[model samples]
Target: MRYSRSFIHTQYEVPKEAETPSHVLLLRGSYIYPAAAGIYSLLPLGHRVAEKIKKIIREEMDGIDGLEVTMPVLNPAELWKATKRYFDIGPELFRFRDRRQREFVLAMTHEEIVTDIAKKFLRSYRDLPVMLYQIQTKVRDEARPRAGLLRVREFQMKDGYSFHPDFEDLDRYYPRIYNAYLRIFARCGLNAVPIEADTGIMGGTGSHEFMLESAHGEDQFVVCTQCDYRANTEKAVGLKPAVKDLSANPPAMASVATPGVKTIGDLMEFFQTTEDHFLKTVAYDADGRLVLAVVRGDFNISVTKLANHLKAVHVDLASEDLLERHGLFGGFLSPVGLKDKNLRVVVDTSVGHETLYIAGGNAVDVHLKNVLPGRDFPVTEQVDIAEVRSGDTCAQCASGRLDVRRGIELGHTFKLGTKYTAPDTMDVTFLGADGANHRVVMGCYGIGVERLMASAVEQWHDEAGIIWPVTIAPYQVILSTLGKSPEVDDAADALYEALRTRWEVLYDDRDESPGVKLKDADLLGIPLRVVVSQRGLKKGTFEVKVRRTGEVFFFGRDEIEAAVARIVADLSPSLDGLPLLPEMG
Candidate 1:
């Protein structure tokens, strides 16, 4: 591509609303333009990067015999209704009614639609195992979208689904896709770590997320240094400390009159005790029912875990009206002396049966002390709902302290079981060897092409600009004409022509100063840069530098082609060698 003919634009000043480095750099480099808070338009440069990532995904998907297919962006509400997602997906689903008054949805994922296809086509046992994939656009109504491509309302994704006869077959095929995901990220010039993750709205028994660690990432996850245990914070588990011995002499529970103290900090300061000594009870409205979620004051509740436990579509802190309706005070409510049978309670295991605690008095400006679980308050439905913190002991090995990092999700794979293929859902079936009907076990895999591109910049950029990985850089070589010397221009033109014949090269043929051209080259992050100047031509050499390492090399005009060949070979042998889509004959 020639620079003068391209629509590439660069900005000197960053946008005021840009928060993350990827957001600022993408805008300044003219790779993306903001359309709204959560929506963006990918410019030519951004489209090229997305295409590169898509090609890598296609290569890996095709290698695994994945049949490529395209599903509609607008899905019928009946399909989602069959899967119960039409109501369960909440406001994130883009739903509307058509002219005929039939409801429809813009799909966030295609599980129901894909399984419906399987139901219509696959009829025999021979079709028990099939993998179908598509590279298509998906839409979700993000409430608070930010971080550029990391959290967007609409974007392109490569989603794949596989069907199997039984759990054993899916178990065998799951690892194949897992390994393929690893290869895809590695070929894209990213170091993504696959960690155990909550399936969330994608209801599955198990799932894994490929995460690229970045300081500006929105998702928090934990990694074990001594072992292979890692998970998203929502699903992360840590060793439970031994319960404190409180049986020496059981103190009677007593209510104390305190004035103007509602928060845990104030209670801790008033009593001069650690946070864990107090029991924090939070009231929530889950599926229209008021429930109290109790945990240690030191830890915050994992809302995801709480919602998942209740199988609720949405959960939020109880409003003042809802709490008042249930005869519950906002900041002074505890499980003890609760007369409302409708008010349910879920306790965290961190508050054991014998552990004594300081709790709310169910009255304003009052608190109870020396209260014990199972004695003062019933211990019902205890689970692990507390957020894991840094320096906590690992749950699996119980030796290493858990280290947390922020990460962007690059890929997700789920063992969906029969969630989509159950008889009442999509109802997909196949004939067995004995001519008996059976449901298909399903698995889903997804990768956001643009998110992977953004994560690459987040992982690889330096102070100057994006340090593109050699495998997926927009162009392997950038040939620049430094000055107005006719001889230097002619030499650069010859080299550009020669290199374009065999390599993906970008020639800076615009009438710009050497400083501007070099700065733009760095911003674009081409892996290899070649400069043509009269001074270097007089020295029988042209300046060549590797963008990643900043190592400079001088090649005589006569030896220019050989030097480029050597450098390309050292960095990457051929564009063909990089993972790419199958040649369309």
Candidate 2:
């Protein structure tokens, strides 16, 4: 389709609010427009690109026999209440009231709605293994939606939820989506890494996140570029460098008086040793008053697991006032009957098994030395609070060292088991061969549509403009008609018509200079460009340019259609079945 002549001179400059590469080019190229924080109005150009990506997603999802269903965007809050997620999801959910004053929300996700539908209609084992899906808009109130379309509050998404009878069934479909995700990213011109995910807020034991590696990314990933291993550090499990029993040989923990020193740095400077040489103790408010938490000071708190230990909704460092109120020292807190309340205590997996170590006095500026763990401060239980970092041991690659990188979460899939099914959920059940009722298991897969577009630009663009993949480009070929003669326009318009039967063509039928047309073509970034100029027309030739590769070829008008058709045909066939899948058997 021909873009508005206005688009050529519209001065598609990047918006001032865009903070990331994708956000800049997307706004500059007229792909998307900001509507509100975390929300956007996808312009024609952006909408077309998003639809193409969604089509690819539909193809892959359908290929997996993913049954398509359109759930309501405004879900009743009761559905979430049934699944116990009404309050569990926290404030990200956009809750509101309808005309009748009934509570509702622009659906943050469809798990609860999908499962509720299943519970009523899906009874018996015959419906045991159903994979249902939908491509719709999910509304989430992101407190800070700064990265343009990358973190929008409301955007298109392809969310799928499946029901199964067993974990093996869930495991089998895991790779189906896994392999499909790889193809989706590859076709979108991205090298996304599949990482071990924590399944946060999603609340599942086994989960994975497809991430595009980039410094501008919001998620953290640990990758072994040497091999094929990668994971999100939030959920990454790897070998930790042994903090070798380097505890002052003879393992003697003695409090040395250096006078008025309190930090590990203070202790290190006085002892003239490295962080690796000392035992690190940190105090945290898990759920109640105060219990000392310890890690090798060198390691970080893997709060993901720590939260699970306290069985609490969330955890954070104690406030200064709370510290003083509890009679605990800020940096010197340790385990010594300071169990103020249900004072939940947690330690790193490394420190969880340590027999004895120095601790805090829980008061003024005193610290315990050579205090054995069980003998010093007794805790009700233990947990892993340290996050694994780079240069640490890699659990998967064994001998290989570990490292980390940041990325955005594009797609996530998890095995949900009975999380959605219960005795009250009579809508979900299967029949055994003996006719007994059996509970069906469940799984889910999701991809953010707008985020995928943003991720591509984040990874593919250069300073010129967006470098869109051929499969998703708004126009597969841009026909730039240059020179003052109308003959050039007629010739290119005819060629554009011929190509339109099988491809998308952007014909620049405007009275503009060759330089202007070319610059605009670069800015629009159609995968291919053809110049119908008077100079070339006189020579019985037209200039054909590959926008991505910038290779120009002078080809005769007579053979131009065939050449362009061949290039497009070669790129069209297989790219169609990917991104989205075909119906499953």
Candidate 3:
């Protein structure tokens, strides 16, 4: 592709609307253009980078027996209705009407469509396992689209689904895809780690997300340095409490008068003790019903964990009316004297039995001191409600301190057992040796193509511009002629034409200063750059520089091609046991 005809416009200043560095540089470099608030146009340079990432994905997916296809952008509304997700996937989904006024939806995901296809084609155990994938655009009505390509309403992705005979088979295939994802990220110049993650909406038993570490990332995850235990905060495990025989040292339940005290802070100050000496109890309305939530005084509650417990789309602190209806005071709500039959009380393990603690007094501006669990108060359920902190002990190895990190999810894979292939629900089946039929287990994987690009920029940029990986730079080399002399122009033109067959060369034939041209070359982030200057002609030599390292060397005109070939050979990552950037037929 010739640079002049590529239709990608160049710019220098960052757009004021862009809030992040990746967004600013990406748009400024003409890699992408905003089509809408959350949508973008992948122009020539941007599209090539994305396509190169996609090719890496293709190679990895195919290594794991993946067969590619083009899935539909619009799926039948009935297919979703049957799966109960038509109404389940609410506002984020883009719903519309066809010409006949029948309701339809742009495909946010292809699980239902894939399941429907399998029901018709997969009949017996002989076809027990299958892997399928597609690279396509997905649309969603994002409430807020910010930070450029990192979070978009519409973008490109490679979504894959697989079917197997049993959970064991599903397990066997999960790791294969996980490793493939590692290779994909590695080839794309991303240093990522696989962290245990929530299966949300994908409806799977377990899942893992490959995360690229970035300060501008939206997801919060915890990584333990001692052991390889990493997990998204929403699904991260907590350290198990050391087994305490709370039955001994039992403290009896008794209420002490305390005025002008309601919250944990008030009680702590009134009692003249640290926060751990008290149990903080709060009430919330889960759906139409009331549930009591208790945690350690110093610990902050995790809303995600609380919502999961209630199995609710949303949960909020109980309103005064709901609390009064549940027979609790508005300002002073306690788990004691539990007379409300419909209300449920759940307490965190931190508020253990045999420990003297303080709680609400069930009356406004009052509190009860020396409250003990299983004695002064009887809780109905136990939970881990507190959020993990930076210095918290590791749950797995117990040696390293747990630390939080911000990361972008570049890839995700899951084992979905019978979630899609249940009988009459997509009804995908395979036959047994004994002539019996069974549902096929499933696995799904996803890669955020644009997110990967944004993360790459986050890691590989300098003060001037992006330092792109040679493995995936938009172009392999840039042919620049710095001076206005016709001889320099002839040398550059010759180099451009000669290098076309061997490389994707960009010729800076425009009248620009040597300094200006070099700055633009740095901004373009091409791997190898060659400048034809008048002085080089006198020495019968040309200047060659590596974009990643900014290492420059002089080479004879005839030897430049071989030097570039050697650099790409040594520096670019290997794919499929082959040299990097093997020319596509």
- Candidates in order, TM-scores: namely 0.96, 0.91, 0.91
160-265: candidate 3 lDDT, tens digit per residue: 9998888887776777787788888888888877898877777779998888788888998999978878888888766734323345555566667776665566
Candidate 1 Cα misplacement greater than 4 A, ranges: 569-585
TM-score, prediction 3: 0.91
Error of 3 at 175 (Å): 1.6
Badly placed stretches (over 4 Å) of model 3 are: 240-267, 282-287, 316-321, 327-332, 423-425, 574-585
Model 1: lDDT equals 0.87
- lDDT of each candidate versus the true structure: 0.87, 0.74, 0.80
What's the TM for model 2? 0.91
- Candidate 1, residues 102-154: lDDT per residue as tens digits? 99999999998998899898888898789999999999999989989989999
Which 10 successive residues of model 1 have the least lDDT summed? 576-585
Name the runs in model 2 displaced over 4 angstroms: 5-13, 225-227, 245-263, 279-292, 336-342, 352-359, 423-427, 569-585
Candidate 1, residue 443: the lDDT equals: 96
